[model samples]
Target: MRIGILLHALFYALVLWKGSQASPYWMGLLLGSGAGFYWYGYNLLSLRETDTKLRGEFGSWTGMLSSLATMAAPLLSGFLIASVREIGYPLVFSLSLAFFAWAFLISQRLVTNEESELPAPIFCRRHPNWNRVLLGNFFQGIREGVFVFFASIMVVMATGSEWALGKFTAVNALFSTVSFFAVGKLLRWYWYNESMLIGSFVSTGAIALFLFGQNYRTIMLYGIITAIFTPFFLVPFAARVFHVIDEAHERYEREYVVEREIVLNGGRVLSIIAFISTYRFLPREWIATYLLLVGSMQILAVLILRNVGFRLKKSF
Candidate 1:
């Protein structure tokens, strides 16, 4: 995971610098999409190996920590872009790379000799439940892509400032961060699937409101609504995956918790491509409406998963 972040920091920097040289938005997105796809594949390979050696909760802890770093990347990037004007993009990326490298070094030092003492895992036959895991995670990718594609245009149209872009994005990030901890506690006390269902309903309603918004105030209001519900939608998905890992571990001593990090990022890469391919011809209002349309798809996913008896089953 540390290596992945290091690669991401370096990758984005190069893409941005080269994109600036060409200065075309679609071109930049194309480069980013390709890199994202490759990252998806790489994460799958790495996580597959880790799955065999680690217990479910232990695997989840590592994944959660890696995600913590991923969450902080944008804030760090924003500071870099804001502070370093002379060698801005590249320098920002370079700093990100340095941070990731330091993290990797720290992770290495923390590894215990016992980590390598575990025997190799005996493979289990593929499980049908894996498909559901993939589906749930894939929609999350679609959700993120759809949100970014449309909301960015709306912010630009409403405020007419790139700076507003940074501010609202920061706002969204902050909201998501707060929701992460809040939802963690919520899950501890409440039903996992129920919270997610409620979140899905709120998200759908909020996106619908986004279609009606025409100014910063409405957009921020919509953002707040998203803040309330978005974590519910996401956190349960991780919890569900952990449930699967736990179940697998119960039957197979050396359990392999298949990581969907690859598929999730791959879906995002595809969504970005789809966004770039179609966004130019679409009006801003239509983009907002399209986002609402995309969000609605989650309702179908929820129904399908429930019908198939994929109930929430978190151990803790």
Candidate 2:
């Protein structure tokens, strides 16, 4: 996992570096590789499933920590872009590369997974129930990928400065971190789907409001609200993935893990391509268009989750 993350950080930095060099194709290839390897690295190469490994709302802790760390990136990038101008992005990416390398070093010292008896595969077909969750996750990924790819650009378009983009993202990260922790605790005490539904509903309303926004302030506000509600779907959905896959069939745990990554990466690739293709054409309203797409997909996700057959456990 650490190596994968380190590689992703490096590749992602390379892609961003290409942005300045006018190498769009190279940037796309690097971006795709980074995303693909990130999945393999996190779930396959680094993961060790033990009794404690699969227990509790593990996604929440990671999500919050990730957001907390990530909040600094945009802020620092904004500062660097403002101060050093053209060299800022490279510096930012280089810093990211260093951070992940440190993480890799630390992870090397962690205990390895304990040996356990492997269960025989009983089911080869994907569960109808599991499919619904993956469907929702995929659509959500599309919305999220596009937003991440274009959000800073949107801020830059509106404000003409990287600092504004940085501030907006920093606040969004703050909200996400807090929301993840709060919603994580809430999910442990209440039904996971309930939090997921509430988050989806609120995020839908905020996205609707965002469509009418024209300035950086309103857009920043939308980002904050969206961040706050994001973990509602994210944390719960993650928990449900463990619930369905681990509880349903221990033997096929690894299969579902792969399937989840496929759905996520598929959506990411589709959305990024869509945005990159249309970025030039939809100059004035591109933000609105993608925001609408995100809102629309999120609504679709809500509908898809409704079709899920299993009742989520109420507590951790």
Candidate 3:
């Protein structure tokens, strides 16, 4: 994790020094690799530290903090850019590097005595349920890949201002934070499937609001609705994944993490390619249809999990 953060810091430093001369492809490669390392290590550590009983709470707090950061970072960046036009981007990049360095330093204090072992080869056959979990993760990633970038771009296009998009995202984050808090308090082990079902349906349905118009109001409504329900889906989904990891046995946890990442990224790449193809080779009006197709992916994930008969306990 520290190495990942150091790499992230290095990436920022290179961008800060090179500015526009930097190749976007190489910069993205560096950033993506750093993210891969960070998330892999983070997920392993989280699995080691959390159990099924408490995983929901852990996910909730993590989501809440992430939402807070999402809310603050945009507003801060926008303020800095507006206030200092000449040096704004560089300043933001520098601040990001400093924060990464701080995170690296903080990570150094973490003490883990667990011994590492070689994970089974990626192609080795796994339990049926494990494969289903990976499939669910893949579908989840498909929705995320399209929605994360496309939704934000649409908001900016609709509002004709980055500032408006930032405010919109901030409001969405606030709603998500509240939703996470409520889910943390109210969610129970037996409710996981039901929560995911409701969240998936509502979130998927919210995408239809775009059919009304691609204006700011419709987009904002969509964002708010998705934000409020996403936690309901995501928190349970995460807990269920970890629960499956536990079922697979402690030794295979690392293997499952690697497999999960690969499958998730594969889905993301496929979705992005599909989106690009649709945009380039199809009519503009087809975009909404594409969004609707991808938006329903969460329901697919829920159905996959349901088919696998995920263990639901009466008590946590």
Best model per lDDT:
3
Best TM-score goes to which candidate?
Answer: 3
Lowest lDDT 10-residue stretch of candidate 1: 51-60
lDDT of 3 by residue, 214-312 (tens): 988888899999999999999989888888888877777888888899999998989999999999999988888888999899899999986665565
Quote the positional error of residue 298 for candidate 3 in Å: 1.0
Q: Give candidate 1's TM-score.
A: 0.68
Q: lDDT of candidate 3 vs native? A: 0.88
Per-model TM-score, in order, reads 0.68, 0.81, 0.96
Query: Which residue pairs show collisions in model 2?
Result: none
Order candidates by lDDT, high to low: 3, 2, 1
Q: 2 or 3, which is superior by TM-score?
A: 3
Candidate 3: residue pairs that collide:
none
C-alpha lDDT of residue 212 in model 1: 67
lDDT of 2 by residue, 102-214 (tens): 77788787666553766444335567777786888799878777766566776888999878888888899999999888875656524656777788888767766656776
Model 1 CA deviation exceeding 4 Å by range = 12-19, 22-91, 110-126, 156-162, 248-266, 273-285, 307-316
